[model samples]
Target: MATSIFFFVLLFTTVLSRTTPDEASRTKTLDITSSIQKILNPFSVKTFNSFKQEENTVSSSSLLSFQLHSRVAVRGTSHKDYNSLTLARLQRDSTRVKSLQTKVDLVVQGIGKSDLKPMESEFQAEKIEGPIISGTSQGSGEYFSRIGVGHPPSQVYMVLDTGSDVNWIQCAPCADCYQQADPIFEPAASSSYSPLNCNTQQCKSLDVSECRNNTCLYEVSYGDGSYTVGDFVTESITFGGSSSVEKVAIGCGHNNEGLFVGAAGLLGLGGGKLSFPSQINATSFSYCLVDRDSDSTSTLEFNGKTSPDAVTAPLVRNSKLDTFYYLDLTGISVAGNAISVSPLAFKVSDNGDGGVIVDSGTAVTRLQTDVYNTLRDEFVKGTRHLTSTNGVALFDTCYNLKSMKSVEVPTVSFRFSNGKELPLPAKNYLIPVDSSGTFCFAFAPTSSSLSIIGNVQQQGTRVSFDLANSLIGFSPNKC
Candidate 1:
C-alpha cells in the first residue's frame, strides 16, 4: 500500500493577546457613536440619527457575507452535459479524497508527538501570471468567495477555508507567485496598508515569523508543498456592500505558489484568533454549500442568523489543534442499520489526537481504516445485486450504473454525540466515476486516527458554527 499524503495545513501557534468574548459581550450593540461622527463630521444629533438609519439599511445582518460558487467552471470550460459534469466531479472528488487522507495524517501528527514533514517534491513549478482564482479545475477541490480589500477597496476572490487559520493574499512585486484570476493586490496603492514590526504583538502570534530588515515576515507551508511567504500587514477589509472592518491583520504574500488557480488568496475561517471572524469579533458564522448541480451560488455568512429548526451539536475543543473545529461523531447507520464500531474510535484523545472534523476544503468524507472497512463491508453486503466494478483511484468500492436508470443505494446517516442524526441521500455517497456509467462509494479509509466530514456530504445543508455558544448546528436541505 502506498503511504497516504495528508492535505490539511496545520498552522503553528502564535500567542493571541485578544481573548474570546463572552455571551453578554456578543449581544452588545455596536458602538455607533464613533462611527457616526466619522461618517458625518460637524453634524447634529438628528443628522447622526438619520445617517444611522441609512447605515442599518446598507449593512447586512451578518458582519460579513459571501456567495460561494463552484470553482470548476471558473477555471475551465463547462462540461457538455450533466453526465459529463458528474463524471468530472467524481474524478475530482477521488483526488480530493486522497488529499483528505493526507490532511488527516497531518492533523494526527500535530496532535501527537510525531515529527511530520511535507511530502517531498509534491508540487512542480508552473509559471503563470495575473491573479488567478483560488482552486484548480482539474482536482484540488475548493469553494471561493469575493470580497473587497484595501482603502479604495479592490475586489478579490478568495478561497473560503475553515481548516486553516491565516488570511493571506498575493501582493504585487511577487518574487515567486502562482497565476491569479485577478490583478495582484497592490498594497502600496492602498494608503491604509501598514507593515507590522517584528516585535508587534500580532507578529509574535504567527506560527512562522521572522524579522527581515526590521519588518515582521511570515511564512506558511501546506501539506501539498504549496506555500505563502511574505510580510505581515494591517489593512481595511470590506464585506457585503457597506460593512467594512479597518486595520485587519492579513498576510501580504510576495511569494505565494500553490494549487490556487481561480482565487487571489485564502479567507481563513478557522477557530484561531487571527482568523477573519475572530478578528472582527463575530459572534457566529454559518455556510450552506449548494449542490454541485445547482447553478446558483451558496452563502457564507459571518455573525449570521441561524435557522431555529437546525439541530444542535456540541463543538468539541481540543487545545492541541485549536485551529480545527472538532465534532463528536458517535457512529454511522446504513439504511437504519447501525454499524458496529468502537465508540472510542470517534472520541478525541486527551492530547487532542483522534476526533471527527467538519472540513470545507476536503471533497469527500473519510473515516479511520478499521471503521471504514467495517462500513464498506456492510455496504457491500447490503447492495450485493449492484454490479461492482474495478475501483477508482483511492476509492475501493465502485459499481456499474449502466443497467439502472437511477441508483438505489442505501441511505446513510451520521450519528452525532448529541443524538442528532444527519441522514445522507444516495447521491451524497454514490459518486459517478465516468461517462461510461461507473459510480463509486464516496467515503474512504484513512491511515491516521482522525476522521473528516467533507463538503460533498455537507452539500445542501446549513452548517452554523456558534463560537459564542460552543455549538455547531445543522439543517438538512436548507440551501
Candidate 2:
C-alpha cells in the first residue's frame, strides 16, 4: 500500500510540473469564471457589480460577515468524469491521512527531545519547516474560500484551514510554481503590496525567517512534502463580498510546490497571531459544511454568532502545537453502548503529544490504534448478521450493501469533557465507496499518539470556534 501511495504521489508530481502554460491558463480562466458564477448567482447583476466596484468604500463594520462555499461543491460544477472522480477523491483522502500520521509522529518526537535540545534545531534537522501560508494538499478533500488581497483587491481562491496559521497566495516572479486553477497574483500590480523588512515586528513573528537583501524571506513545509517559500507582506484582504480589512499580514509566495489543484493558496484560520482570525480581530468564526453529495452550497462565515441551541465544549490549548485546535474527547459510544477506552488515551502527554484535534484539512476521522480496535470490534459485533466484504487499503470494515434491502447502522457519539456530546449520523461513519452497493467505515487507525476528527464527521454540522472564550460549539443540520 505504501509503495502504491508513493507511486501516485510521483505521478501527480509529474503531471503538475508537466502542465503546459496554455493548458494552465485555459484551466485557470474556466475555474475563475465557474467560481464567479457560483458566488454571484444568488445576487443580481447590479448588486454584484456594485459590490466589486465600491469595495473600497465598504466600511470594516459593514464587512464583518461573509460566507464561502466548499471547493468540492465548486469543483462538481466542472467535473465531467464522475465515474473516476469518486475513486480519485478516496485515493487522495488516503494519502492525506498518511501524511497527517507522519506529522503526528514528528511532533511527538520533537517534543520528547525538547528537554535534550532546542525544538527548533530538531525540527530543522528533520527538514520540518515552520508555519508559512501554503494551500491544503488536494487529497484532503477540503473546502476553499474566495478572498481578495492587496489594494484594488485581486480575488483569489484559497483552502480554508483551521490547522494552519499563515495566510498566503501564489505571487508573480516565481522561481518555481505549481499550476493553479486561478491566475497567479502579481504583487507589482497591487499598490498596497509592500514587503516587510527583516527588522520589523511582523517579520520577527515568523517561525522561520531569513534576511534577503533587507526583505524578510520565509519558508514553510508541510508533512506531505508540500512547501512554500516567499516574502512576507501586508495588504488589504476582502472577505465574502463586501467586508474588507486593511493592512493585513500575508505571504506573497514566489516559490511554491504542492498538490493544490484549484486553489491559489490557503486562508489560515488557526488561533496563532499570524492567522486570519487573529489578524482580523474576529471574536468567533463558524462554518456549516453541506453533505458531500448535495449540490446545495454551504457557508463559512467570519465573526458569526453562535447558535443559541449549539452545544459547547472547552477547547484544549497546547503551546507546543499551537497551530491546531485541540479538544478533550472523554469517551465514544456506538448505538448507545459505551466503549471502554481510557481517558488517558485521549489526553495529551507531558511531552506535548497524544491528543484529539478537530481538523478541517483531514477527510476521515483517525483514532489511536487501541481505541480504534475497540470501536471496530464493537461495530463488527453490532452488525454481525450482515455479509462482510474485503477491506479497502485503510478502511477495514466494508459491507456489501447489495445483500440487504436496508442497512441498520448504529449512531456514533463523541463525548467531550465539557459535558457536550456529538451524535453523528450514519452517513458520517459509513461512506459509499463506489457506484456499487459497497460501503466502508470512514474511521481509520493511526500508529501515532494523536487522534483527529476530520471533515467527514463534521458534515451537516455548524462548527463554531470562539477563540476569545476558548470554546468550540456544534449544531447539527444548521446549514
RMSD for each model, in Å, please? 17.2, 16.3
Best by lDDT: 2
Q: Could you estimate the TM-score for every candidate? A: 0.78, 0.79
Please write out the lDDT profile of model 2 over residues 1-479, one tens digit for every residue.
99999999999988878775424322111122222233332222221121222222322333454445554444543333332444556566666666656655666677332232222321242344433223344234357665678777787667777877888888998867787766789898999888899898777777676777898877666655677778889988876545678888888887776767557788888777898888888888888777555445556676767788988888898766677788878998876667999879999887677888888877778899999999988888777766788886678898877544456666678888987777777777877655455667789888888898988899889899888788889998888
Reference-based lDDT, each prediction = 0.69, 0.70
The regions of model 2 sitting more than 4 angstroms off are 1-63, 77-87, 101-107, 111-141, 403-406
Question: What overall lDDT, based on C-alpha atoms, would model 2 receive against the true structure?
Answer: 0.70
Q: Write the per-residue lDDT of candidate 1 for residues 1-479, one digit (tens) a residue.
A: 12222222211111122223322222112122322222221111111111111111122546577666655423433445444544455555555444444544556566332343322231223422333323432224456677788988887778778877778899988877787767899988998899999888778778777786888877756544467778899989876656789988899988877667547888888887788888888889988887543334667887877678987788998776667788878889876678999979988887556788888877778799999998899888867878898987668898876556654556677888888876675666776655466678889887767788888788778899999988888888776
- Candidate 1: global Cα-lDDT? 0.69
Superposition error at 323 for model 2 (Å): 0.6
